[model samples]
Target: MFLRTVTTAATLLAMGVTASLAQDPIEERQQIMKDNGQAMRVLVPMARGQADYDAEAALAAFVSIRDDAARFGELFPEGTETGGDTRAKPEIWTDREGFDAAVAAFVEDAEAAVAAAPADLDAFRPVFGAMAENCGDCHEVYQVPEN
Candidate 1:
């Protein structure tokens, strides 16, 4: 009886995970959008801080932003759920060509943003803000956070 109960519990857990994965792709995208936003929140402050001039801090923030952005792109094509967590806006799917262009633009902007980070810790106001703007444009149209 105990063995049966444990097996049932495990099966139920597996089903639950599958069910969650089947949830609207938009929901997953929303979560990713939120995560990206959170990461951005952490990064900008560190860069903007007076102490950000330190070599270590700037490098860390750049790496963090780049890594997070790369993870965000995972939801688009490379993910198991290509259709899942992809509140990429209906237009993106329908206007495939234009959408691809936008995504390319984002990648370029993000890469440039990270590259622009100075080795000696300089004022990254312009580049970082541009990076955020690139992300923001997509989120504005494609991502919606759940209430």
Candidate 2:
């Protein structure tokens, strides 16, 4: 009897730890977006000629954004719309296909930017612009405007 009781308690404890390990989706998604934004800040100045372009830094930035974009759709799971101070729109759940397509496009653009490997500001401009546009397009329809 004592062994059975101890086993059940251990099982319950393990479940509690597992549940706590899962982040709230809204916070998780926001952190991912913030990380992507930080990566952009590293590349945008170089692309705009405001800072000297470093190929390695640019590649790293693209990789960061692409990695984050790859997981974008998975982060918007249902029931995550209103809580944890989310800026995600309800339309994300209703128009899931559109939301998903946008994420795919963002990922594609990031990959293209990485493959292009622009060595200078001029070469990087168009690729950077396209990626920025993808971000704006997704934000326009899926995210709530910040006050």
Candidate 3:
């Protein structure tokens, strides 16, 4: 009987841990944005000619952004307009159609960058610049300014 009780307690503890690991939408989206930022860190210096152009690194960054873009819209579910220290503007929920279109444009740009597979600095510049602009435009409309 004692062994069974202990086993049950362990199972309950494991379940609680799993539940805690499940992130709410705000947390999930924040993580996705953070990941995109990391990818940008990899690409931006090369774009600026501050770092050597690396085709492999550039492609990886593009892929990371593309993958994140694919799921980014889904992370902004109906009730996620607030909380979790979100910088998401209410415009995301209020202007859902526009927000979605912006996300679509970003996804398209990311995919194009990956497909273009820029092999040199000259080739990468245009593709990277376009994607960067997309990010800025979306943030202008959809995100609150950081304090």
Candidate 4:
């Protein structure tokens, strides 16, 4: 009975440790980006005029971006550069200042997009385009191309 209890306790402890380590920085940041993508999807059809414009939805999407932007820097801590199928380019660490600036610019633009939330599909195009431009700029410089 004592041996059985110890075995179960060890198994439970190992599971706890595994769960804690499961979400490393790379996975955490990727999940954040995935969430951002989800928000963008909410705005895509409206921006293209395929769906009726919804100001509340547009603003909420922008807010999601803004919120994620604030946590951008924390997701790229040192030593997390090469692991777990990360697509982060070495340039992110090599040009840390530039990468940080890009993140800051994204945060600023995200906020601007939120504040300039469009009331109509026509108005949303430019605003969404500008925010997307920031994302593209960072990805071009910092993200590794997928094979």
**Maximum-TM-score candidate:** 3
- RMSD list, candidates in order: 11.1, 12.2, 10.9, 11.6
**Per-prediction backbone clash count:** 2, 0, 0, 0
Worst 10 residues of 1 by lDDT: 73-82
Looking at candidate 4, the ten consecutive residues that score lowest on lDDT are 10-19
Candidate 4 residue-wise lDDT, 11-114, digit = tens? 45544643464468787688667767877787778877788887877786787678778877878989989988999999999999999999998998888888
TM-score of 3: 0.84
Q: Return whichever of 2 and 3 wins on TM-score.
A: 3
Q: Please give, for residues 1-147, the per-residue lDDT of candidate 2 as tens digits.
A: 664465456445534643453577666678777767777788778867888887767776787688668777898887787888889999999999899889999999999998998887777888889999999999999999999
Clash count in backbone of candidate 3:
0
What lDDT does candidate 2 reach at residue 68?
A: 66
Error of 1 at 94 (Å): 1.5
Give lDDT for model 1.
0.55
The lDDT for every candidate, in the order shown, is 0.55, 0.79, 0.83, 0.79
Mind giving the per-residue lDDT tens digits that candidate 3 earns over 1-147? 664465456445534643453478777677677768877898999998899998877887798789778888988888877778989999998899999999999999999999999999999999999999999999999999888
Best by lDDT: 3
Clashing pairs in 1: 25-85, 25-86
Candidates sorted on TM-score, descending: 3, 2, 4, 1
